[model samples]
Each structure stands twice: as structure tokens, then as C-alpha cells.
Target chain A: MDKRFWVLLGLFLLMTAAGLLLGEARFVFANASLICLSCIGIQ
Target chain B: MAFFARFTDALARLRRAPVQLTSTLLWNSYFLAPWLKNVPCPGFNCYSCPLAITACPIGTLQHFIIIRRVPLYLLGVLGLIGTLFGRTACGWTCPFGFLQDLLYKVPLPKWRVSNRWAPARYVIFALLVVIIPFIALEPWFCKLCPAGALEAGLPMIALQADLRELTGLLFAVKMVILALFLLWMMVTSRPFCRFVCPLGTIYGPFNRLSGMRLHFEESRCQHCDLCRHVCPTGLYPPEEIDTAGCIRCMECLKACPHGALQSCATGTSCTERSHA
Candidate 1:
């Protein structure tokens, strides 16, 4: 693998760790709970 | 040699079917229920779809951006997927991509969009997915996205009377766009993927950096346009082999008569050495 691969992998790991620490999963669930009406422009 | 080539092509398509089928099922596993919904899938499966198993990353990104919060989870998941497989997710996993593939099989007169329009997707990524959402505090892409309209909007409207009543000019506009896209797909391959998908914009740049990559050997070139003909996206394989536009579908590999094009892990000669 090249240096770019390692760099990207490292960045991904850091972001994943940060996401876990920040409890972004809760926010993801919140975002997921209802259908995005604005997305479909229903609202 | 022709018989051998045909056999190889058939074998490759047979191999591709399982992966494509598995990805389709996994993305549409809405029946798996509440647990899967918490996780965001890599590409643009609309969360509003009754059969969607996971959240749409683009939608989640817009939500976070609209709320002025960091989309750490979405970014991390997308980054991992991109770095590993690049736009292979778009090629194999996205339901919208699958729909486009099916539509292209309708035996219509296929027309090729000029590659000049390829950069439009990046503009869409910047304007609709990012800039518009940040400025207007809304998921602007979703409002106009045909995928959302087809997967979530129409279905929900069909299922719920209230939603149907609420449908107005916006819904009509969305439906019009969807109809146009449907018509376009009959004549062109993956017009949305090439021109509109914001998720493809994000995942595309990783094609060269991904673990899986397309390798081309110039020594084996025969100058035949078989690769070009077999490519669903009509990309010139020799020039754009590892470009962001490539979905890593390996159609070129199956089409190459000279045993020139192959796919392998980055820095690995496994496909080359074995197939050569």
C-alpha cells in the first residue's frame, strides 16, 4: 500500500473514534427516525 | 479463442450477480427493522423508502450541516467505504444505480452523453448537497432528488392519504424530474450517476486510492473498442481506467480480448500475474 492509503485509513479511524466519543449514533438515530420530508419535498 | 473469451465473459457476469444481489438485498432490508435504521448506509438509499434498511448518508450529512453540527458518523462511514472500495458502492450497492441498470436493459436506442457533462456532478455535490443546505438550512438535494421522489415520496403518498393531500407543486416538480430521469435512463446509462449523484461526487475521488483498483497493461493493448462497447457508462477504459467516474464494475476486464485490463488490490499483482 502507498502512503495515501495509510493516511486515509488513519483519518477514517480517527473520525470513527471521534464519532463514537461524541455519541453521533444517537444523532444518526434521530435523523433516521422520521422520513426526511424535506428530502422528498413533501413538507 | 472466441469461445474461451465468451466463457470468461459469462463467468464474470455470473460472479458479479451474487455480489450485486447481496448488496441489493442488504440495502433494501427494511424488514430487518429498527436496529438497522440507526446505521447509515454508504451511498444514497433514501431513508424514506419503506424497504430501506438504513439511513441515507447524504440526507444525514444535510441534517447535520443544516443544524450546524458535525456529521462525524456519516463522514467516518463514508470515508471508510470510499477508501476501501471507492464508487464500487455506487456500482453494486445503490438501489438507484440498480434501477438505472435495469432501465438501460429496456432495448431502447442508447445514446452517449458527452463526457463534458461529467463535471456537473461535482457542481451538484457542492451546490445542492453542501452549499444550499448550509445556506438555506434544508436538505436541498433531497427536495429535488428523483431517488427520494421514487423511493420515498411516491410510495409514502400511495400508502398515506394525508401525504397525497399535501402533495402540490413541489411534488409535481419532483415527479416531473423523476419522469425525465426515467426517460433519460431508457436512452442513456446511469445519467444520474454521471451527472447528478452527490454521493458519487464524494466517493469518486477515492477510485485511485481505494484498496481495489483497475490495472491496465499498455503492452497488451489491441486497440479494439470492446471495452468501450461493454462499459455501461461508455467510458474509454484505457484513458479513464482508474478515474473517479469508474464504478469499478470490471466490465472492461471481461471485455478485454488482449488480457490487458484487470482488477486487483492496490500494490498487488495478483490479478495481473494470475490472469496474464
Candidate 2:
């Protein structure tokens, strides 16, 4: 697979996991997590 | 007649700006986005957002779809934008597109899907406009919308007031989906624009034949591959542009140093550049 493909896959999984985990704590947790993933990791 | 012509010329120039100042001014001055009640047009604003000054077209449409009524006001807003610039609104005025542009600025591994993926947008369009509202009796598009998350969800939740009480499993679910999409966008070009944006779907078909479209000067052909390469959507200029897939982002305009590409109205001649 291409490098970006791997990076994207990895980021997707990481963000998804983080969202589910933090989402249980506070609804905002999911949004915060996503913004971070999109703004920091994927970006 | 001279005065009217001058006014038209000024309006044309304003519409052509890389960034539309009128949208910005309207947003702020008139509370263009109902969600950003505190700020004018605060960019990326959504109307369903508790504080918005203007209504969201998508939200309004969804509301109408669910209720089985036509939303004249919402349609008017979109029709007005369409009448003037067609999909130019996607490029210049949309807060969501602006937000996506900012996300694109981040240094990350980005991938562009094949043209095959373009059809998925139609599926999203269908679901948002047809299926979801019929089943849910509410605008499901707004629920999953990143615009809502940023414009409404975050602000209302942060404020800890009336809307805070509305937060629940559905809101949480929407937030999760939103994060995944945004993170994916960081890795990919535009997940929402490509796959799940109903607004894009609405404007997509119109863009193909819109008075505003990229006119190719077949004579100016160096065929340098720059236009093709620079196109974020990977559209082949030689073929009919898949307007649904094009956000009119103008990457090709800048990429074509040869001045071969120009945005013009349908059936316009190539002898001179003209805006429709």
C-alpha cells in the first residue's frame, strides 16, 4: 500500500477508537477528539 | 443606463473576488448565519445552530423534506446564489468549504480517490434529500453535519445552556461520525464534499452547465498535464466536467499557467474570457 494509504488507515482507526472511548465521558469529547485528529494527525 | 452598468460592473467585481467580502459583510451585519447570533457570518456558520442569525439551507430543506412541505425561503436562498454564480457559491461563499480549506492547509498525508468514487456523492444526496427525512421525521442531515457540529453542537454545548439539555446519544453519535470524517479528510482530500455532502450534490449537477464553468481554450493546448495534475478532484478537462464532483475550487485555474482555462457561462465562445 502507499504511504498515505497506511497513514490514513492508521489515523482513521485511531480517531475512531478515540471517539468511542471519549464519547462515553462527555459528548463534547467526541467532537474535540475529531477536531484534533482532523486538525493535527490527518492534516 | 450608465449608472446601472457601473453598478453591475462593481457587483461583478465583488462576486469575482477570491474571497467574497459581501458574504462576510452580510453574515456579520445581518446575522447571516443564525448559529452565529453573536458574530456576523462568523464563517462556517449554520442556522440550526441555536445562535445562528441566518438559516442553513440544508437544514431548511431537510425540515421541509421531513414535513412534506416546500421551503420557499430556503429554496430562494439557494436559487438566489445559483442565479448569480451557480456553484461559485461553493468556492467563494460556503462556510463549510471555507472550513474544509483550512483543514486542507494542515500538513498531512492526503489521498485522492479514483473517479469511481464520485457516484457515492449521489448516494449521499439521495439519502439526505429523500430517505433520511422520510424515516426520521426530522432533518437527519443536520444531525450528522459537521457544520452543525462546529457551528451548533460545540457552541451550544460549550455554553452550557438550553441546547445543552438537548445533547444525547444522537448528538454523541453525530460527533463521533464527524470526527472520523474530519480525520479522514486530513488523510484524504474531501471526504464530505466527495461522499456525504447533500449541499454539494444539490449544486453539483447545476455546475456542469452553469453559466459559471471552466472554459477550455482547445487552441491554447500545451496539454502540459498541469491542469489535470493540479485538479484536486482529478477531473479530466478534456471530458465533460463532472460538476457534481467539482467544488469549483479553482485549482486548475492557477495550475494552468498557459491561460487555457477560464470560468465562463455555458455555450460561451473561447475568443475572449467572459463571466456569465
Candidate 3:
């Protein structure tokens, strides 16, 4: 581990926090909770 | 006596078997928590699996792309994992990777995918998962994802008559893709992780920058080739320990009889010879 690791950790933490504030987790749930028909390879 | 010896050899040679098996069960334990769909696990699982509990990171990323939204949460979560442990998740926690591991264990001669074609996964990440979804307003990768086919498509079609009626060319294509990979994994080592996985694409670059590291002691090395022999990704650890191609399976660490490969995380002292 070096400065790069720490720097990136902080960067990603901020990105996650920002994503949380942006309500992206809800989007993830909405998509993931339901079986995605497209993902199931159905037309 | 030979059968007993073979059994003993297999037991002693087990690497990440416990963790991998446990993770596969946990990931597929849908009844544990459907609410965890919002959270993404650190592997390439298909969220659509009947038994899957959390979101698939690659699938989630693709959905976000299709919807014209940035998947910051997914990306950040994956980035955190990648920064801390690199591609260790692929080796230890990925259900699909475990499948490949099991497939390669079948009694057969084995071959290796070339290191030169490793960069092809990046192209897959860019085109199939990202660019195509954004442009076409479809999760194109998901439509053809082998993991999705194995985990959800085949099962859904098998269990539901309506789903069977709905199956079409798209499902057949995904099945063929899945079949090719299944056959390929039997003859080679982790061909999908090495040449196709987009999640591995995100984590691969972080190997050079992750908190965890592989420490190579040059003084102890006789270049015995044991590490490379045990490596599922077929990397020669001495020369390519933390290369983007490495999934950080730690078979090298376990297989080095001379103890040349040591694991060092943020707290451990690998300052002198750490690959990262």
C-alpha cells in the first residue's frame, strides 16, 4: 500500500457517498429486485 | 492406495475452496435478504438468479448505462473493493469463477489462454457493457451474459411454462455463449475472467495500486515454475505478480515451496519487495 491506494480509497469513498446522496442505490434496487427480463435473455 | 493418494492430494491442494463455496452459498441465498438488492456484491453474479440476493455489479452498471444514469454507487463500491484487495474477489468470492475452478478440475489435459489476449477484456468492458448499452438503450451485455443465462434464463425457462413460451433467439444466443464458455473452461483456466469479464476489467487495473500485495522474495526464488503451474490465470508470478492480468488468486503464494511469495496488506511490511 502506498499513497496511491489511500488516494484512491478516499476518491471512491467520496464517489460512493455522492452516489448515495444522488439516490442511485434506489435505482439499483429497482432494477435488481425484479427479475430483469432482458437479463433473463427474454424478448 | 492410488485412490487414497489422489484424494489426499486433492484435499491438500485445495485453495480458497472454503471461502469460494461459502460465498457461492451466501450469494445464492436469496431468502437471506431480498432487500440487499440495492447493494452490489464484489463478484460477477447475475442479480436475476432465483437464489441471488444482491445486485450484479456488471449488470447494474449496464442498467445504469441504458437508463443514461451514472452508476456511481456501483462503481464506487467496486472501486473500494478493487483498491483494497484488487481482483481477489474474482478468485475467492465469484460464483462463476468457482464454476470455472470446478470445471478445470475434471480429469482432462489442460491448456492456457495466452497472456497477450488479456487486454481483450477491457474492450469487452468498453463496448459490450458500456458503449453499446448507452447507444442502443439496451443492456446488450445482459442480453447475452453467460452468467445471466446460467443463473436466470435456463432456470426461468425450465420452471415457468410462460417463460418457456417467451424464449426466443436471444435466449438461444445466450445459451450458446454459455455453452462455449463451459466447454472452454474445462480445457483451460478461467478463460472468462481472463478474456471476457467486465467486472474483472474494473478490478484488474487496481492490482498495481491496491492495499493488498504479493511480496516476491527474489533471494528465495529458484524459478521452479510452481507458482505459474498453480496459477489459474496462467501468470508467471515472478514477472507478472501484480499485472492487470492477475486475478490475485494467491495460488502462487500457496504453491511456492520456497515461500518466495508472501501476502502483505496495508499493515504488513512488504516495503522492500512488494509488487504493488
Candidate 4:
């Protein structure tokens, strides 16, 4: 696999794990936040 | 031969009388101003745009974010269209992209952005998704959007009281930017898709993984620069075939007389259609 894929995979997995540990609503909100950040510039 | 067949299908759709007129009206009103009333389409057409027949999907998505509602109906609508068309919305349906397309028709000098600029989309994507929702209290994307200037700012300023009193500074700045971009487009073809547009940023990654894709048979390529020359997005097709920057506008396909490139859905290849 590409190096960038591993990096992205790591980040996604880390976020997902954190969300699962944190709970459902927060996880959804966090995922939404990631999506939002991805939508526009992250600054 | 296979390439010509796909181009023919696209051309046929373009010539379809009802589709042609409706798309033309949608494309024209997108920039010209004043829609008949409120309609909802799967892509961003500012609700505030005078001639808008649709509410922006991004705006509505933000609404769901704020209200904490699931946007069941809106998601259903967006999802249904997305499943069928993917980034076809960017090419065919999006008012903002259409505006950029029109601007690109102007005659002028232009430059192609570097791949270093590709990261800028992710930055825009982050800002639109994270900062706007968390910081700004309104439709954050709309506030600074030239699309909004064409869609909402012009008409709302005319029709509404408080909006009328507002100074033209912000709107003027946006217009100047739009004019500059249009000039750039005349020269460059698609500077906005290449360097700007957050929605394009969003839909772009999806295009790579979408059922719809640009397929390349590297063997057919004679190292000729024709496809690269015709590409408005200025993507290096040989080096990076599936970059997220591709808008799938198909100009390269049209420009290629060699039948090298094609728009394909899934595993379907022009060379193997009979087997399928």
C-alpha cells in the first residue's frame, strides 16, 4: 500500500477508536467535524 | 472507435431538446439572476440567488449540522443523486461550477496551478467543514462565496430593505475576484476547478472512487501531449491518473483524436464491452 494510505488509515483508525471509546453521539459529531474540516480549509 | 461511441452518447444527451433547454435555463439563471421560485437540487445553488430554482446542498447540510437534525429528506435527496451521478453534479448540475465554466469561456492570459496547490483544496475542505460550523453562526460558505454574490447578493440587495442598505464593499470585492477569475478562465480554461472551489474539493476525491471514472490504457498512449494540452485542469494524466483534482469535464477526451481516453463506469472497458 502507498505510504499516504497508511498515514490516512492511521488517522482514520485513531479517530474511529477514540470515537468508539467516547460514545455514539460524540462519535457522530466528531465524524461530522472531520467531514466539515474536510469540506473547507482546516485553519 | 470505442472512444467515439462514448462521446456520441454524451453528445446525444447534450442534444436532447428538453435536457438541453432545462440545462441551459439552469446554467443561465445560475449566473444571470432571478429564478421563478424555490426549488431544491442536489448541489449548491444559493437559496438567496434571485433566479435560483434550488437550495444549496451544502447550506442545507450545514443546517442539519446546526439544528442537530438528521436531514433525512435532504440526505435522501442528495444521496440518491450522488449514488447515480457522483461528480456529474459538478459537471452538469452545479450552478457554481457552471458559473466558473462560463467565466472560463472569456479570452485572456492564464496559468495552470501546480500539484502543490492540490493541498489547498483539503485546507478549504477543512475550513468549510470544521471552522465555519464551529466559528461562524450562519452559512459560512455563503458569506464569502462569489456564487452567493451572483445568486443571493444581487437580488437580495434589490428586493430586501436591510440588505439594500448594506454597502457594496464585500460584494464588490467578490465581483473583482470573480472578474479576475473569469479573465483567468479565458486564458487558463478551469482555474477555479484546478485551484479553488471547496465543493469541487469535496466531490473531487469521490470522483476517483466513483463508479464514474476516466480510464486510461497506458499502452494506447504514444507519449503524445494532446490530452495534456487539451486538459483545462492541467492534470498530468500520465503521471497521476486518479488525482482528486479531476472534475471529469471530458474536454481531454474530446480533444484526443486517438481514441485513447474514456469515461467509464466501474469495470466496464471499451475494449471488453462485448465480453460483459
Candidate 5:
């Protein structure tokens, strides 16, 4: 792999860790579990 | 010996079918939703599908936009996948893409979607996923998405008859959009992936830098354009092998008679000078 590839991998990994620390996972999970009527094209 | 040979031949003919089918089943396995919905699915699938186990990354991304939060976790997961295999998920995992592949198999005339439309994906993503949702505080793309209509809207309405009460002009519009796209699929190789999928837009650029990449040996190539015929995204492999447009379906690799195109692996720098 090139230096560029490693740089991107680290960047994404850091983002994921930061997001997790910020509790975005819980936010995503909480939102995802709810079936929004708008998503299924319902009014 | 004959049986072993036959088995190998059958598997070869099957190619990506088995993996694609397995992925389609696993992602929409319904019962797995409780544990998996926290994570974003790599391909374009509607998380609202009755059987969907994981959240649609595009849909989740829109929710974040609507809520005025940065989608760091979802983007990280998607970015990691893009870094790993590029748009491989579009080829082998997307249930919606699988449906298109199956529809295209009908004995109908096929036409290639033009490369000119490639930028349309970026436009669509920007408008529906980010701009509109952020402005309206609503998931606009999900409202119009045919995949959502096919997997979630129709099924949910059909199963829960009471939902029909909520199905109004907007629902009819979604159905019409779905019908048009379905017809479009019969004559096109991958119209949605090539020109419309926001998830594909997100992953498309990574094809150039992904660990799993395409390597073309120009020294042996006669430019027969056989790869172009087999490519799901209509990419001419010689010049456009790993561009922002390539899904890394690898059909070009198998179609090259001269063995000029090969899938290069991670940790190995492709010595070929021409490729990006």
C-alpha cells in the first residue's frame, strides 16, 4: 500500500472512534429502529 | 473426475450470483434487525424494508442531515468499506442492484447508460440527501426512492392494510417512479448504479484508492473492447478501469482475452505506471 492509502484508513478509523465516543452509534441505532412513515412513502 | 469438473464448471458459470444472493438474503433477513440496524449497510437497501436487518446508509445519512448532525459514524463505516473494496458492495451485496441485474437478464435489448450521466449521481445526492433534507427537515430521497417503495412501501402497505389509509398522492407517485425504474432496468445494465445511487456516489471515488483495485497491462492489450461489453457499469476498462465511475465489478478482468486486466490486491503496489 502507498502512504496515501494508510493516511485515508487512519482518517476514517479516527472518525469512527470519534463518532462512537460522541455516542453517534446510539443516535443512529435509536433513529434506525423507528420506521418513519415518510420513508415508506406514507403521508 | 467428471463430477468434480462439472461442479467447478457450474460454479464458474454462477460467478457472482451465489455471493450476491447470499448477501441479499443476509441483509434482509428480518430477524437480525435488532442487532444489526445500528450499522449502515454498504449497498443501497431500504432500511424500512420489513426484512431489512441493517440501516440503509443513504437513508441514515439523510436522517443525520435532517437532524443537523454530522454523520460521522455512518460515514466512517462507509468510508472504511470504500477504502477496503471500493464499490464492490454495489456489485455483490446491494439487493436493489441484484434486482436490476435480474431484471436485465430478461430477453430484451440492452443499452449502455452514458458516462455523461455519472455526475448526476453527485447532483442527486447533494440535492436529495443533503440540501433538501437539511432545508426541509425531512428525508426527501427516501420518499422518492424506488428501493424503499419496492421493499418497504408496497410490502408494508400490503401487509398492514391500515397503512393504505396513509397512502395518498405521494404513495401513487412513488409507485409510478418505481414502475418507471423497473421498466428502465429491463433495457439498461445498471442505470441506477451508474447514474443515480447516492451510496454509489459515496463509494465511486474510492475505486481509485481502494485496496482491491484494477490493474491493466497495456503492453498486451489490443483494445478489443471485450471488457466494455461485460462491464456492468459500461466502463471501457482500458482507460476507465479505476476511475470515479468504476464499481469494481471485475467483469472486465474476466473478459480480457489477453489477460491484460487483473484484480490487484492490497499491500501490493501495482507496478503499472499508467493507472491512478
Candidate 6:
């Protein structure tokens, strides 16, 4: 609607595309399986 | 008029119930059995929970930081949600927030903290979520996170026998924090969201930029302070409507006797064109 909103949306899209292109998606997928024990402070 | 106002309030609660229930089910998708585990939830549902369907973003952030990798996916997903609805997810979707709401409904004496201390959550975001994780090479915030303890640690330990044997000083410490938060919620509503949650901190700034927002009509003048009284987080509604502290619960809208408050998708105030 506003210029700022459009700019923010553009930036978000660009970053998301960059993340996908750089293979960060694979990293995220790999780490998803291991239970985040640190998140529960167990580690 | 009183009957109408009461009806409006009931309707709002009814609207909120379905959202809260659906969110809870989605987050705790153990019933779905590993359907969406690879995806990260925007809210603070712990990944280690047996029932959790998605990874926790904060946990994912810390993991990436530990591995010396950029958390592009996590950042992108969080960015998308923040840009759209801001902390509305925290208010309506987070299981921990829902738990806090239920805890506050317990008949206990309530307390209100000074709004001056509101910046403490940002400090936590900076220190525990960002700095400590980068330096310590671990999720330092998670060690002390009450949500992690309540949702993941305790549940997993109860369900799995091996996890109980793994308990030690760290588990005890996490339990203490969870107990304190549980007690605090009984006295003060949504204490974590107002004072601690790192995810809330990340989403807070987006409140100003988000598409959805609360519109306040200054023309309808009756400063009855009912909006302030109804706010679970004790925020003064009109002035702080777009501030990071607002969770977008819309209680103030229900409490507005003059129908001065409304939530709008457009940045422009709907009241300017019509009484919508």
C-alpha cells in the first residue's frame, strides 16, 4: 500500500531467494531432524 | 447499549477461541506424526517437544550461529510473517502465549509492572538470543527459557524413560525458571511476552510497518480508561497501539465504549471514511 511496505516486501523476497540459492535450505532441512536439546537446555 | 457491548465482547472471545485452538493443534502436531517437522514455526514452539510439528526459530537461529552458518531460511520466514502481521502471531498463535492466558484466568490476585521496564525484552533479545549464542556457541537463552522447559523438556522427560535419567543441574534450573514463570502468569497476564520473549522482540519493531494495524479515532472523545483496564498486558491502548508491546489481542476494541477503536488492514484509519 505504502512505499515503505513495498520496499520491505521487496527486500524480504530478495533475501528469501538468496537464501534458497545459497543452499541454506538444505542446512535447515538437515538440522531439523535433531531435537533441539539446547532449546530445552538439556545439552 | 450494555447488552450490545456485552454481545460484542462475547463475539470477540468466540472469534479468538477458534484461532487459538487451531494454532495450538498446528503447533502440537504430534497427531500429524512428523508431517511438518522440517518447517520452522514462526512462534516459540520448542522443537524438542514430542508433539511439535515445526522447529523453533530461535533454536534454529542458535543452531546456525553455532555452526557458523547464516540462518537464511529462518530469517526469511520470520521476516515474511513480521512484515505481514507483526506480533499478531504471538497474541493469537503461540501455544505458550495461550498457556499464559489460561494461567491468568486462575482466580488469583493480579499485579501490574511499570511500563518503563518494557524495554527489558529487547535487552533479552540482544543478549541471550543473539550475543550469548554467538559467543557461547550454544543457545544460552534456551537454557533459561521457561517455554522450552514447559513444552519440550518436561514433556519429553515424562514420555521417555531415558530422558529422565539424563536429568541434572541444568534440567533443575530450567524447571525453576518455568515454575517462576507459571507463578508469575497467575499474578500477571502474558508476563513473558511483555518482558522476556526474544521472538516477541523480533516481531515488535514490525508493528509499525505491518499491513494489519489497530486504528484509533481521536474524535470520539471519552477517556474512560476502560481500554487500559481491559488490556491484559497493561498497555495504554491509544498511545501504544502500534508499539512493540502490543500483541494485537483487540481487547481494547471490545472495551471501547464509544466504538473508538477498530482493527484495519490498510494503513489508513477506516474511521476517516466511515464508522467501520
Strongest candidate by TM-score: 1
Sliding window of 10 residues with minimal summed lDDT for model 4 chain B:
B267-276
lDDT of 3 by residue, B1-276 (tens): 133223223322565888899999999998888788899988889999999988999888888887788778888999999987788789889999999999999888877668799889888889999999899988888898899999999888888898888888898898999999999999999999999999999998888787776667899899899998888998889989878888877778667777677665544464322232
As for candidate 6, its clashing pairs are none
Off by over 4 Å in 1: B1-14, B273-276
Model 4, DockQ value? Answer: 0.04
* TM-score of every candidate: 0.92, 0.70, 0.92, 0.69, 0.92, 0.91
Best by lDDT: 3
Say which prediction, candidate 3 or candidate 6, comes out ahead on lDDT. Answer: 3
Query: Model 6, B1-276: lDDT tens per residue?
Result: 233223323434456657777898888877775757656787778877778878788877887887888777678778888877778788788888888888999999888787788799889988888888889888898888898898888887888788788788899999988999999999998899999988988899988887666667787849999999888778888788868898877778867878677565544534321222
Task: Mark the regions of model 2 whose C-alpha exceeds 4 Å error after superposition.
Answer: A1-43, B1-45, B161-166, B240-242, B271-276
Least well predicted 10-residue stretch by lDDT in candidate 5 chain B: B1-10
Backbone clash total, candidate 2: 16
Rank ordering of all candidates by DockQ, starting from the highest? 3, 1, 5, 6, 4, 2
In lDDT terms, how accurate is model 1?
Answer: 0.80
Name the better of 2 and 3 by lDDT. Answer: 3
True contacts kept of 6: 0.55
Task: List the TM-score for candidate 5's chain B.
Answer: 0.91
For B1-276, candidate 4 gives per-residue lDDT tens digits of 344335434642352234324664674464554332222354455554445544555665665565555544444444334433445665655555665566666655565666677677677656764467656655566456655565556556666676455545556666665567656666665566666666566566655444445666667667787778766567766665446776555555655555566556544554312110
Score each candidate by Cα lDDT.
0.80, 0.54, 0.83, 0.53, 0.81, 0.77
Candidate 4 Cα deviation (angstroms), residue B116: 2.3
- The candidate, 3 or 5, that scores higher on DockQ is 3
lDDT of 5 by residue, B50-98 (tens): 8888888988898888778898889899999998778878887888899
Better of 3 and 4 by TM-score: 3
Interface RMSD of each: 3.6, 18.7, 5.1, 12.0, 3.9, 3.9
